[model samples]
Target: MAWYMNSVEDLAELYNRVKEKNIPIERVSDHGHAIGIYIHDPDGNGIELSYEMPASEWGHDPSGYMIGGTAKGRLSGPWDEALARQAQVTA
Candidate 1:
């Protein structure tokens, strides 16, 4: 449900094209260097299109990784133990 447009003008043009086809667009907004649009697909699921931040803002930085048991506050219950023991599987 996401897309990237290099510039605002391209985003606007695409919006107009869809409008010509009588589609329903809920809203559009600018998020700093990126822009996002919200709409409903024909089946009514929400959809989002976005232009991502410049590549400089993204890279391999392990500092952002969250320790499994530390998420959602201190792990104090059975669910926490299950999460901690989950196999190291990646999708």
Candidate 2:
């Protein structure tokens, strides 16, 4: 199950909350057009809490799907850093 977060700030705050609660994080994945904080539900279903890139930054595939390839060599931009860049992004 994937839940979309409204902004990087919301995602970053949740990241901090998840850490404080000591919940095991599955992974933080950067999917080019989105960033997700993944974890499992109590019933063991995989859950992705994500923030998508602005419409301007999204890419479309020739096949009609949104581009979602992960970045090569180290996933970039954990929640907090991404949140910090929101200022630049909005500017």
- Among all candidates shown, the one with the greatest lDDT: 2
Task: Write the residue-wise lDDT of candidate 1 on 13-45 in tens digits.
Answer: 766676678776666544433556677889998
Residue pairs of candidate 1 with colliding backbone atoms? none
Off by over 4 Å in 1: 53-91
Going through the candidates in the order shown, the clash numbers are: 0, 0
Task: Please state every model's RMSD to the true fold in angstroms.
Answer: 14.4, 8.7
Question: Candidate 1's error at 49, in angstroms?
Answer: 2.0
- Give the number of colliding residue pairs in candidate 1: 0
| RMSD after Cα superposition, model 1 | 14.4
- Against the hidden reference, what TM-scores do the models get? 0.51, 0.62
- Tens digits of per-residue lDDT for model 2, 35-58: 788889889999988887676556
Q: Which regions of candidate 2 deviate over 4 angstroms?
A: 59-91
